[model samples]
Target: WNIENIIDNATLKYSVNFVEDVVNLDVSPGASGIGCTEMVISNLGTITIDVDVEVSGDNITISPGAVSVTLAPEGNITTPICALALTRSEARAHPVSVLALGRETNTHLNQVQVTSNFTAIVDPYARLSIQAPMPAKHCIGSTFWTNFTGVNNGNANDSVVFEVSNIQELEDAGFTFTLPILQYQLEPALLDPLKQNSFQNLVIKVDSENVTEGYYNMIVTIATTMDGESFSAATTYQIWMANCQEQDANIEDDSLPSISLIPTLIAIGIIAMRRRY
Candidate 1:
């Protein structure tokens, strides 16, 4: 049953026709020797129509002398990576489509056309996790260690590099010397995998300097392999004068010295009284 014959000689009837329906279709003609013209007709319910036609050209021969093709319009593809915040101005984000080439009817044409429809919306998909033996604030003279964990939900391992900086301004702002000045590093232990579920840690050390008791601030900057790509995070630690100040003040307030002499004196007096009796 050729499509050209059915459209040309069939009777199409409508059980109910209330309003006017107009069908419109457009198709790009194929190359000189490669593609064929696609025709489509749409109506409410079913339409039975009668037609008479004659073919004159040898190149225009019809198939079964025709074929039936169900025309389905392309649909929108959902982009999951859209949730990540990507800098579209500096970077272009792309997606992996599920539709494979072999399954496509028109491999080259349809696949390319469908790929154009997939979209990715940008968001903050990059995540960071920091861990350390102690909090960011430590004594100025004390050595404290910390770890920073980062994940490129946006890219893979070796995709980004990191840096650590010592900020003196953090001390001027009131960070205590009791809390050591901080430094940071990305640990080698965390760089094996680069997935949304994967993460790497940055090990940080706060080495307190032998200076006035004050606080300090530290910053960690992460950059792409090229350094131009970077992000930053920070923590604080401090060192202060020893804790013996209060103990020194308390000693000064004692009215008398705490001595064992009183017990020896009283025992001697009792022995002398017994001897006299």
Candidate 2:
């Protein structure tokens, strides 16, 4: 029983060449990164394969790396095989370079091989965009509303509305607005119907003049709904004779911040400081 006659084997020589301008590897998790070169010999003809491959700067070379073979139509062939392992240190470390594969066989076995190169690139981080409205400041006798909007990166469609106020009708004698100094409401179906998130909250800033210079207070009532729950954000500010005079200052400023009290409808308001000169 000749051992060579009982086996069918083949030899495969493999080498690698890093392509030019294809370096700087950037790999992610669970990703196949640059590592080693492999050689697979299919349909072996009862033979022994001894592969000795050496890699240099961007190049791979095979030595005496051939296989000798004998074939049996139907039998088990056992042969000695050798493998070569290449590491990152074995290759040229350049930002951009190519590896070349070369083969050399001192045997009569047929040579089978292939080559390829990989590309590198930088990965980018993700970010989110948010949209919102600017706050508005208004004066007494000013019929207006303030609008606010905000988008959350964590909760894109979630937001809320809140309000505070202090209205005083007279001074020294102490007084309060006979009527609510300011009222506000949220638009865009506060708490999106589809998303079901909190509605954006708005805080109305009444011109300090909403009340008299004496002692006075103004009320700011804010209303909105979230998660089918009705919530209110309101506050009150003391108003006095100074508040009434503050309105004069607001009128003089001419550049008071204005807002669309009603959606689609724009109104004017004044922002000014009352200085006790």
lDDT for 39 in candidate 1 is 23
Off by over 4 Å in 1: 1-140, 167-197, 225-277
Cα displacement (angstroms), candidate 1, residue 269, comes to 20
lDDT of 2 by residue, 100-191 (tens): 22222346355343333333322211112222233333334443333333222221122343333333222222322223333222223212
Error of 1 at 72 (Å): 17
lDDT of 1 at 214: 40
What C-alpha lDDT values do all the predictions have?
0.32, 0.31
Instruction: Kindly report which residue stretches of model 2 are placed more than 4 angstroms away from their true locations once superposed.
Output: 1-109, 115-125, 129-245, 249-277
Best by lDDT: 1
Provide TM-scores for the models.
Answer: 0.32, 0.21
CA RMSD for every model?
Answer: 17.1, 20.4
Candidate 1: tens digits of C-alpha lDDT, residues 168-247: 65445433323232332222223334433454556655444443444333555554442333544444323333324444
